[model samples]
Target: MVDTSDLLPKTPRYLKVPLIILNTILWLLGIVLVACGGYALSKLSHLDDIINVSLPAGIIVIGVFFLVLTVVGCVVAYKEKLVGLVFYTVFMLILLVCLIGVGGGAFSYRNDAAKPIGTAWDKATNDERNIAQEFFDCCCWTDANSTCGSNCQVVNETGSVVPNLNKTTCNITVVDYVQKNLYVAGAAGVTVGVIEFISMLFALFLIVRICKNPRPKSYD
Candidate 1:
């Protein structure tokens, strides 16, 4: 019977420790992303009318993928499995492509962002309207109607505001809010891509190193 242990690739000491450290970073990053995505989805889902669910959902997807990569990387490093290392490198490439696609697509979407945002105003629930109004210190979408949300208020009595304090409309408020957050997401995606790219290089190096110098079988 053949011993399977000998088939594992030998991880050189120089790269081995660094690879483990990189995988640990991936693990922490995955946790942060998953948490952030989940929080955004749960706490801010009501604003979906103005912002798409795909944003948070995409974050969760990338976070989970990173988690998987962390496991794969750890295993390959510990077991010195060449096959697993190759797969790790492949997964890293796929992740990098996805990051570029998502980041690029999101930035493109931002270029014409106002169109959908303008349309979404009408579809917002009253609760969402109130939330946006309060946060942006606005009244109505048009602020033309005499009626207003919580954000608009008369001063006290004597020196009271003529109608309400906020002069801007919710329409303007929501648009600005969404655009800023979108920029943040795009930047974060780029950062993740950079990290994945570096990890990919490390994996490739480990693969070549293993191929050139396979670990010798143990003598009993």
Candidate 2:
């Protein structure tokens, strides 16, 4: 029955607004990352599209998880309760794991994907000398009565004929681009998804901790 009001400091007026804003932003980012990850997963068949559309999305989404963890930790630390302290500690640990997981995923994907692109670029560049204008000749191959190159342009990820003269034949270049990006993004998406899930876990922990702990009475 002893009064507990004096045990805790008055909550700061400035703190709550920032915490709420941060929490909302972090949550939004996590949600976006998941959505982008899903989109990337869905576009698995189209490597170029996957890379173009999904990789950056995954990175952003994953990056949000770290931000969320930071916000949650800040809130708990500022509050100065046993539950808050515990939540903060746990969240930091989770953030560490997420950092490593996402970093490794991105690194691994980039490394693996780079090799193929290097090869393709080398092949394309070397072959370009022999067939200097072949790419340009094939432009608009999809159109009727368009004849530029005698050899058929390579098929790309989209199943369209490569149709550029100045650039890599559209399909080959695109397929190569997509293939490389997809590899990189696949790794990235996995990492981001893991991070987001971990952030959510921390958020859950925070909620539970807050609910279970006793709050100090407003008046002393």
Candidate 3:
């Protein structure tokens, strides 16, 4: 079923060698992304509605894409197949679009990233609030400190425990943390986008190189 007319391209040592090395790094990165996302999903499935679960899910998707591409890329480079190279080049372009979209979307939604957390805080039970208060080292839901849980002592309550009021509020602290991290994610997306664009250019140039100097099928 082989095409008798199929030809292999002459690849430069400099280009081919670096491509292979970068592919290895990309392969390992793919595995890490999948594993990290899977762990987060398993451990914190309960936070799906409370937090943006899409982040981990998106990581998994990207990881799978990279893993699949690594195989196609390796084969194309090894066999010098024109068809496979075309697919690889197209996939890289698709990935570039994806990275840009993710970066832009995250930046646009940076301010809204903590809305769900704030809502969750408003609906949280005293036990839940106490846990958050202990973690964030804050009292109640707002600066009012009107709703102290066991984590923070109540003024009128009589017990062996002394009242310990924190100056900050839990809602403010939690929202600030989420917003800051979301901004970081947005920035990371843009950085990765630039790196990917350069990698894509390498693939594009390889295509042109192959087309210009392809060897006859019998030459190999």
Candidate 4:
């Protein structure tokens, strides 16, 4: 009888070719995600309006930092080098931070930002409120409204009369500035969320592919 052992096929000495291909794709995706985040961060400074909060600063710093690391990681991956572990670890952590900031900023802005503006609107006379409401309706939550939600209503006192547009109390520029900043914040929050999701997916793919590949039999 023929020797059965000699008839069996040898197992691959390294990762399967398909898994290596998938890992390479994942590494490329990670590079794209990180690069997009960097572009968003760099463009932030040029935007017409931005909230001067730690959030934007953090985004800019972290985003750029990850971008550099990801680019290096891509070069390493192309060599079929085992750098996915490092890339996935760093990216996963970065995604967590981004998710937190995005969720917090969006929730807080919707609640907290409206409070002062709404209160001011409510304290103003109907005419003033109407004007302020118009501003809010047109500006404060324009992005949200586009998605079918009601815009922020300026808070106005029920019986107060509209204040005169005297030079002392009226500053339309200030209101306009606030509106622009709010819009910027909302857009940034949404963008951060999207980037975070993409980052997360790439991280997962890299980690999964890394895990699937065992050490070569030669190493054993």
Candidate 5:
């Protein structure tokens, strides 16, 4: 029989250790991303009407994708499976593309968030306004003196109207809050994308090394 053993790639000792360590770190990062997504969703759930529900949902999806990718990466790195490494690399590339797209969308949305926020404020019923006011700790959607019905009350503990409290309207405050959050999300996407790019490069380097010298060695 032809010796197939010689065709197998021998994994270097140095490469094995770093691969395991890096993959483990990646796995933990994936868990952290998932938790971040869950937290974001929980926070956004309170403002269901005013915020875009899809954004939090998308974060959750991305987190889950990273989790899956991490698991696959660990398995491939442990087994030193060349095909699995290639698949992992390709998946990472796809994920990097997705992250870039998400980042761009978030950054672009920051500029466009004001209009939607205004519309939501305009369409807000009394209950919705109260919810927003109570959550944001603000008085009215616009100026404090502007008509906001019963929800625009800026009262102190003694039921006395708190002067100048209404000056800080939810329109400005909420819009600023949303824009800040979008910027944060965009930054996070870019950061994760860079990490994914690095991971792909590592995988490709291993793939090339394995192709050069096909030998098999057990890491366990």
Candidate 6:
């Protein structure tokens, strides 16, 4: 009888390609999260007493976790290690939960950012209000009637003189500023969470496939 074992087709290596791609995408996402978290921490450094510092720090920590996950995943994929794959998948599931929570919190916080902004304005003293008005180029919290003096002057971006009669208020300016940053953070969180969710599913699939088609043992 002819030896037919030699004619058997070897398992294609394509199964691992998706896992590699997903890990790479996750690594890039982690980098972005770290950058955003760092930037936010710097921007909010002045408000450390008012805002919670833990939020930004948590983001940075999560980013670092993702980076570590990527490294572990790459090693497991290269070595076709079943135990490492299982560990990575479990860790990913845990991270998915955290990411969901963070994304929800960010979105909710962005929606309600106006309250804290108004509170800050209310707490500021007259001198502080004046300094804010000068920096933001606004008259008062809501309108001229709120606190803007009768002779408040408005300057346009072109350095042209404009009547401060109906200029934008500090309330709108500050609220807009806060909301804009929050929006960016919220969107990023949601996007990263979604990507991670997909990654978790892909990883689980990879684990199953690897289990079925176990890598050949080397005697070396």
Pairing residues by index, what is the TM-score of model 1?
A: 0.77
Ranking by lDDT: 1, 5, 6, 3, 2, 4
lDDT of each: 0.74, 0.48, 0.66, 0.44, 0.74, 0.71
Cα shift from native, residue 52, model 4 (Å): 5.0
User: Which model is ahead, 3 or 6, in terms of lDDT?
Assistant: 6
Sorting all predicted structures by TM-score, with the top scorer first, yields 5, 1, 6, 3, 4, 2
What lDDT tens digits, residue by residue, belong to model 5 across residues 1-220?
Answer: 7886644335544454566666667667667767877887887687778777676677778878888887888788667688999998888888888889878998998998989887877776767777777777776766534435365655778888643343477778888988887898889888778767777767776787777865646435
- Summed backbone clashes in each candidate are 0, 8, 0, 8, 5, 0
Error of 3 at 106 (Å): 2.7
In the order shown, what is each candidate's alpha-carbon RMSD?
A: 7.1, 11.4, 6.6, 11.5, 6.3, 7.6
TM-score of each: 0.77, 0.39, 0.72, 0.41, 0.79, 0.73
Task: Give a tens-digit lDDT track for model 6, residues 98-204.
Answer: 87777677678778877876776667565666666665667676643455433455678999754464657877886676667667766777787777777666667
**What lDDT score goes with residue 142 in model 3?**
64
For model 1, the stretches where C-alpha displacement exceeds 4 angstroms are: 1-11, 125-137, 143-167
lDDT, residue 163, model 5 = 38
Model 6 TM-score (2 dp): 0.73
Off by over 4 Å in 2: 1-13, 45-81, 116-215
Measured with C-alpha atoms, the lDDT of residue 89 in candidate 2 is 53
Candidate 6 runs further than 4 Å off? 1-12, 50-54, 124-140, 144-168
Q: What is the Å distance of residue 29 in model 3 from its true position? A: 2.8
Model 5, residue 57: C-alpha shift (Å):
1.7
- Between candidates 1 and 2, the TM-score winner: 1
Q: What's model 4's overall lDDT?
A: 0.44
